[model samples]
Target chain A: MTDSFSGQEKSNAWSIKRRLTILYVVSAFGILLISTVFLYWVLTTRLAKEDGQFLAAKINLLREILAEAPNNKEVLQEEVEWETAPFRLAKYYARILDSRGRVLIETGKMDTVAPSYIFPRPARLGQTPSHAAMRKSTNGHSLLVMTALARVGDSRGQTRILQLALDISHEDELISDYRSRLLLVLLAGILLSAGVGVFVAGRGLKPIEKITRTVQHISAHQLHRRLGQSDWPLELNELAGAFDGMLDRLEDSFNRLTQFSADLAHELRTPINNLIGETEVALSRERVVEDYREVLESSLEEYSRLSHVIESLLFLARAESSEARIEKKLFDPRKEIEDVIEFYEAMAEERGVTVTYRKASAAAGSGFVNADPTFFRQALSNLISNALRYTRQGGKIEIGVEWGTDGGLNISVADNGMGIEPEHLGRIFDRFYRADSSRSENKPGSGLGLAIVKSIMQLHHGSASVKSEPGKGTKVTLSFPD
Target chain B: MRILIVEDESKAAAYLKKGLSENGFVVDTSSEGDGGLALMEKNEYALVILDVMLPGRDGWDILSEIRRRGIATPVLFLTAKDSVQDRVKGLDLGADDYLVKPFAFSELLARVRTVLRRGPVRQPDILNIADLEIDLLRHRAARQGTKLDLTPKEFSLLALLARRCGEVVSRALIADQVWGMNFDSDTNVVDVAVRRLRRKVDDPFEKKLIQTVRGVGYMIEND
Candidate 1:
């Protein structure tokens, strides 16, 4: 993977950004080296030209001086001899040669320097005291020889020329040393930039590595673990906040699911215990026909209770899964409630609890509503049963159904019993939540009744609410949308 | 009255023995089908309570073997596998009664009395235990020519115990037998009724017939 990422052919071995930066510095140093070499070439060439010019002028003066003498050749030779003396000038080396390109003046020093030299040829040389630079070789010594032709004593006599040469080996050595130092500086700069690039890349990617490790250690059960958003860099802080928020939601849902399952098991235990107890009792004894019949009856009752609890649990589960299909049909809510209340009338009468119903005058004609009759009846029955259980023997219980303002339906059950306290009123619909006395002492019921009612109401696209005072009474209202 | 217990578990069988012997019934036990059948073939028992899930030979097999051999001892099947089909099947297999497991001892005693009684038409109208005699058909109780006016609950409670005179009966069994399914465990119905019955049946007498076993149950024993 690293090879693939780094192997873009067009990219320089160094990154484009780094190459550009280094290139700027290295190219400037290269230009500086080239300029220094050019400056040295120009300066040395000009100095050599000036030295040749000065020697030519000196040769003209000597020619005039020697021509004025009584013996020209001997005088010229004597003058050259004096000028070429070793103590004359250390930087200058001069020689005089005849038109035949031979040594004309016998300067003892010049004799060794230019025993055989290529003075400018007579015809090829310029006419009016011209100058030419040439190379000389004598007795295994090499020199940069400059020669100039000139006239003597205002007349062209003997056609003598002046020659000068200088050794430039020391200047060449100094320029070579400077070039080596520049090369070393450029190589060091490249190595240092590569080290800086690596450090910067590692520092920039550190937070990304930290985020990866933190996420890997997190598990569903450990929702309390957080990314500690404050510790994250500004670039990643938003992501950490969102992660913590999602964990909060997940924790809440997990807690609710566990509690719901526990409540379901707790509710089912009552019927299961009863069933096991009664069946065990019946099986452990020998009985005649009459006694067997009584045991069978109790056993059957327990079986029915078990089936009821199981079916409710199944319905609740299906509702949660969104698989509970309501068998929609038109049903008379008022008549249905009335019939249920009438069915339970005998029990209420036996207990001296009065059962009543108050149906709206228009309800008879407008009682039809689309709902699952089975679930509807179950919801209504649970409400009535809860009412009957709570109310004292002489208390009154009433059921009502009417049409609401938005063409919706409303149903309610009111009981003049020991009403629920304010604190418990809101939580009554939560599964397995029961008010203190009615749940613990007076009567026992699977506290899933209200939860089942709420689920059924949800299936019907309705809402359920409760209104009550501690001692006065309680009214449960259910409303369905049209 | 003679009774037979067919159970696989020895501890349960011993407990049954202790209880039935204390209640005054002549109790015989068998841990297997053939042994129970051999006992049944040699003696005529008033009742036989059999357990369904047994090793070697099951309760149904023993019941079938007894019936096939023409021993018409009244049989009750007590089993832990208490499904509806098991109940129907036991009844069809000629079991006189069926009870599930973990039953109260008093219920077992009640059922034993019920099964031990002679056929409906030939049942003895009067049941007697020592000096105490009960006219069950008339619902009357008397001891040594003294008439006892017992309430309905008291009469039924005493009659059930008197019928199984020497057996130890646990309170759970008594509660199940006396109140049946109508009473909840939270109520003191069984103890209250037993107290009332004890007053009428044993309190006034010098020789106490009804004895209480600590942490166990009540028993009708000789002084």
Candidate 2:
């Protein structure tokens, strides 16, 4: 029904300016029509009252003369007839009748122009007979005819009928002229309303247009730009703030992505340069079998490093994607961490780092995790090796499980190794972020060890945090939800 | 033993053929999926090494076809997708085993041997390698009746390499089978453990049983 009522897309989907203008015009038109009709009615009523009173007054005067002096001809001709009178009433007719219905006096041509039959019958002999009517004269003039009975002042003590008529064709012409002028005023009012509506609506929606222009200028390269909310009204503040917040988040992620790609290229280039340079040098001249064997082994090592980087990259990518499927199972986290400690035992022993697992004295019981066992172990292994890498001889590493503040489980690995510098503490978990880059150049990590651990924790809907005191120890915790 | 490797990359197929031939298996190679399926149809082989992404009719189709025809040749899927879903899908389609690509050739060799050795494997309680005796039931080892002192994990590592006897076992396999560490780590944990085991198991004897196959893995072989 709304579609049919609208009739067309342009009207139904009118712009705010057009819609407001049309509404203004329609309301103005309605008000003008009603008031114009009311004024016309009031005017019509007043004119009719005046005409009736004029005829009554003339009859009353004529009645007076007939009773006091029935033969007063000059007075009747001047006042009652109004034919040659100097009054502003240009056209009128009067007639008098005797008690037995005989025409006593009448203005010349009163019978021809307004016959007696056209007037209402006079009231029966006593009451002042009063009636007024509109009729076309015999000569095509509009007339208002009225009749009344008046008692004479003479000794006869009889009642006589008096008839009078007035022409109103000039008044009708004046009313029609008033109506056409009113119509012109009404049309002008509607147009002015539409104009005012357009101006007002445009002023109200100017801010939204400004917003569109600002938004159009922003691209991926200009994500840092924001729709500052301070200039907007209260109603638009929320929209502006939300837009700025989205841009903030977008800019942050885009920066991280850009940094990640650069890091990836650098990490990959390191090993490829080595492989190419070493292979090219080896093939520059013939070498002994042992030399060739050594070169090939070195190339194989580079290949393994390249493969490891790819593997870690893939794992990080998969863990970040929402669709990376992790098959969770219920298991004791303490037991899982213990297995990784055992796995890293021999390596730690060679470095004289005693790695062990123990329940935190503050812990209530063995805490379990609904997590993928493979990912959990990998995370723990990375942390253990990171600890082992920095630990000096006789350094100690401890793995502990305890209840978190929020009733979840917290698994921590604390090592009395070389603690990290305070400045590098924050970004240790970023991919390819190395703390002591030159020192860790020949280290066992792929530079993604901690990043992978962080990714794994994220996949479990958990968090990983680190606290370190240089020269004392460093502690890394994985907090899992209850 | 006989095996067929269906792979698209020419270098991968050639190296796989070389490695399997060196391991004493009569190996055949095909670069297309349909051709590999036809080869298996006309010939009887002990096992099929199938690569998942092929030019025509992929590895899954070929494996399903081989199984549909009632041929009992065990198939091991070799593909690059390491997702759990793809692994389950391959196994669900009658693949005997699954090995992800960029695989250590030794791991492939180990899987191939396992697939061909279908059905039950019966072994005596003891495995003898020269004078060294490993008692699988007791979790003890001795050379010429002198019991070697070893930790439980060390004993298990010995048992894993001993089970494969003369075969070269990759470090990843050793880590997984012995310590249950499935992810790749750049640490020398496995190598360190092997060295510790060799100190007790091989250093005092005139003959060494354990050997490091340089950047590949470890093996305990006696001549």
Candidate 3:
């Protein structure tokens, strides 16, 4: 009754729902983190590219002006210092160097912030002069610096080196502002995802928890409780169905055991009570030796009957038990049938009941069964005797071996006498079940004959069934698998 | 012949002693394992009936000890355990035979006789119970010098009862010995067979040789 786990028990630190939630959170966080980092990289790369193009445009403007007026240093300086908007994308610093790397013309603050030597090497002439590098100035200002070869003198004359710098401190502050905002969003996303993961996982596993609660409330006496098969999901429906199937088998076995015990006690109480009463009365006075002998003999007979019941019960138990090892060999069913018939021939002749054995002409195969010969004999013997008991004088009892429709061998014993009533036929194979108890009292049997027959059939992995018509006859057939 | 019974249950030991004594055996009973062993050491018995479950010095230990001392006395085990493993264990320990408890007295007696009659069976060609004679070799039965017509099964049945002439043979034993059916078939088949045999072997004469012992079994004797 203690429904303890049969194997090694596992001690888990976390519940299944918790584990599912953690798995969901970890995988989701991984995907979100990758995308967030990629977004930041794209934004920063775009801002840097724009700054480089802006520096290139400023270098091109210097190239155009110097080509028209070669010594106009003031004009180049004024062009570098001019700003149309009060709030620019970035502040620019430009310096023009001659062929000897001398500063011919420069912005006022260009030397202090750029210090000319910190610029990139000039590009080839007639090129776009793009691709600037970013550097931090000595005074803690962020700058984009670039150099290019520009034509000076008339229409692409001498080449001049133009160094330009863009102060990106304002852009850096804007990108930093975006980075912190993104961090806040990521943190919020993590918290939101974990919360949703917990909810979703709990919702998905709610059925399993319901099953556990139902199972926990079910003890031995509460076997009637069931996990209703309809409410479960598709995957768990199979599990629930199987569990209910097992419960059905268990309940059936439990009911049978209860009925069997009650019947056994009732059956045993009669003979035992008779023995006690018979002995007590016999010893009531100084009885004669003959009387005492008769009582003792009767008591021994009672004991023998009780002993037979016990033996039959044990045989039934052993056959049904998992450890019952039946030794099977390939043997002809005809031979065992012959032997059983021979044993019953005397009884048959005594009753004037004609018993016949036949092998149906339509039967196929060699008619040999791979089964325990003793059990076969016992099964045939019980069936034959039962047939003989039911048959009247001048009646016919026929036994035959034939191939059933499904290819299994069928051994049936049919009699032409008073048949059983239909209402009593359903439980005919139950232990100690007699249709007409009053009539069976006159006859001799422990009423376990058919039960033993049924048990033996089960051990052979076969089945026993009965077909009877109230006034016609009863035919019991045993089917063995092919 | 002498026999020693070591059984802790007093009622079982007492009835066994009485039965064996009545059957003309010099029986000795012991309620303890050590006492039984001491008796076995002091007395030379033809057979020892030992119960496997005892108060002290289990029957197996006593048996092994006796065999260890090189004693060749036959030992028959009586126990409530009817499992095949237990039976094989008893035999493997050199016991002569085994019988489960709640056993019929006739079965125990028959087993005891068979155990005592070990080593080269004595098959008599002809058995005489007063005027009835059973020819074992020829498979024939005759009374008053007239041949009794019986089938082979009937002949074997008569022979079995004649061989164990005066002792009561149980119905289960008869069914097993004759039909090779080992279960206690709760039926009157044995009674019917015996009745048919009685018609052929006993009905014709004034004296009945095959006698039913009334709820026990059959025995062939001139009584």
Candidate 4:
């Protein structure tokens, strides 16, 4: 059973660790992905704005030159000089269109490029100097184009549309490079987080592993070992404590079992040794018939003793195993006690012990109880016999039946005899346990009478308890359910 | 009468065989189940004394085989398993009687006799114990030609006690036999009845026939 349980626990531990690692990786990757997308968007938007601004400034310079020139040809000449400036490193193009939509001045680079719809045209002649920026492909190169409607030389009626373009392929390439690098970094971050997650999960489960190891070291033989609860975390400390408690119970039962077996062997050995020694001695000689008869009779006594032990042991075993069925029926408790008292009357008389029965005034008329009469009698008889065994000659043994304080039936056998010590009262019901060990030598019992009584009470779903004080008296109570 | 003993423990088997043989029985012993079964199949025995735990095959299986073959031979189960369920199971399997181990040899003999008496072959109607004679068919008992007045229960109890003469019969057994009671009554009804029976069976006679075995029960034996 433990093997299967541990196997299940191992799988559970593995799954927990795996799940923790997966959870960590998934959340980390999600955050990283969102932040990367946001950063890329911000950088690209800024770059596009800067490009638009640069194109607008270049367009302004062209507008100024066009306004200053006397004719369209001189305007072209000034444009060429402006384009030749050392600061203007990027390839540039420009075109000027009148209000009639006729191109008046065009730069040398503009003639080579196609006339594409890079930006929207102004609705009217001047409409607050409308400006727009767009992208166009020229000669297999991507360019940013900015168009504006400017009033030349401050003439309110005169207006010209200025179109400026700048090659921005380098900026596009830089943005793409940053995007790929961001993706690589995101992958690395996921891997690193997964590794750290696994490490942390393993550390978190270290205490459980330690507990399992400690428990595994404790075999059936070494049940005293415990998982040190002080070293464990709070949750696992509870688990360790539970485990230690279970071990305590196991050790207690194991010790009891070991002791029971040893006691059983000892009890059997005495009678067997007597039988064997007497028989062997008798067989060693050619005895007369009467001598043989005497030997047989002596051996029969030993056999009878052995038989009693076996019978009591079997009864206890059956009771413990739940094989002894108690046929519960409604019967008179007082009548039952009276019957037991009557049964022991002959023996009590022979032993010179006075036995009496008492019924409480509160329970005098009420007699019915749901219990197994035979088992109740058996329990009562056992107690009465014990009382007879311990009570001095001419002493009194009172058997009483009454309603218990808690409302159930209570039958108590109190003997004013050689009482048991207070310490021995608790364990008197243990199998093969003797209250007065010295007095046991003279008592002809299997030392199982009280144990059998206890078992009988248990079979009836009741409880048996004893109270005793030295030099006073002993009282045993069998409390039954209502 | 012939009997077959199937037991694993050699010492127990030997003692059983010796005791039964001394009691005028032709006893055969087997220590294994298969051999015991084979002996049962071949021989006509008065009864079979079987132990529950045996090598080669268990007592339950052997008994089942015997019954399955349509043989109604009586079987008395002798076992160390004294639980009520074991006894019920043995009886359910067609065993005539069940005796727990570490039992008194006298008890075993009495049970064996009871089982054998249940067979189809009828025992003699007359039972003799020294000078006392019990006529079962006529329901009469006499001591030295003097007829003794006895009730039906007293006669049956005396007959049972006389059959297993010189052996102690517990009050529980007497209650079971005479009163047909399976559960003890907590009262000394059996002892009281026996005391009444003893007055009639022994008080008038010079030589007492019924004797009390203290702490046990009663025995009808001549001194």
Per-candidate iRMSD: 13.0, 1.4, 1.4, 5.8
Give each model's whole-structure lDDT: 0.68, 0.84, 0.84, 0.78
Per residue, candidate 1 scores C-alpha lDDT tens digits across A1-482 of 45655434675466544555566556655666576667667766775675556656665566566456525666665556665564333334566665566666555655565544454443323332344354544544434455566554455565656555543334445556756665665566556555665565557667867987897787877877888778888878988888888788788667766776776676667666766787688778887887767766566545544544555565566665555667768777766666556445545765678878887676435677678776776687778778877888899988877786668777889999989999988678876678774454223565667878898899988888999988878899888767
Q: What is the lDDT of residue A390 in candidate 4?
A: 83
Model 3, native contacts kept: 0.40
- Candidate 3 lDDT over B24-126, as tens digits, reads 9999999988898899889999999999999768999988998998999999999887677788899999999999877988889989999888779978899
lDDT of 3: 0.84
Task: Output the worst ten-in-a-row residue range by lDDT, candidate 1 chain B.
Answer: B180-189
Across residues A322-366, which tens digit of lDDT does each residue of candidate 4 receive?
467878998787777776676666567766888998877764448
C-alpha TM-score for every candidate: 0.36, 0.72, 0.80, 0.65
Task: Tell me the chain A TM-score of model 1.
Answer: 0.46
Model 3 / residue B162 / CA error / Å? 3.7
Cα-based lDDT at residue A75, candidate 2: 79
Chain B TM-score (model 3 vs. true structure): 0.96
Give the Å error, residue A426, model 4: 3.3
Which ten residues in a row are the worst by lDDT in model 4 chain A?
Answer: A123-132
lDDT (Cα, tens digit) per residue for candidate 4, span B1-111 = 999999999999999999899888999999998898889889999899999999878999999998998888899998878777888899999999988777767678778
Q: What TM-score quantifies how close candidate 4 is to the native fold? A: 0.65
Tell me the DockQ of each model, to 2 decimals: 0.02, 0.53, 0.56, 0.15
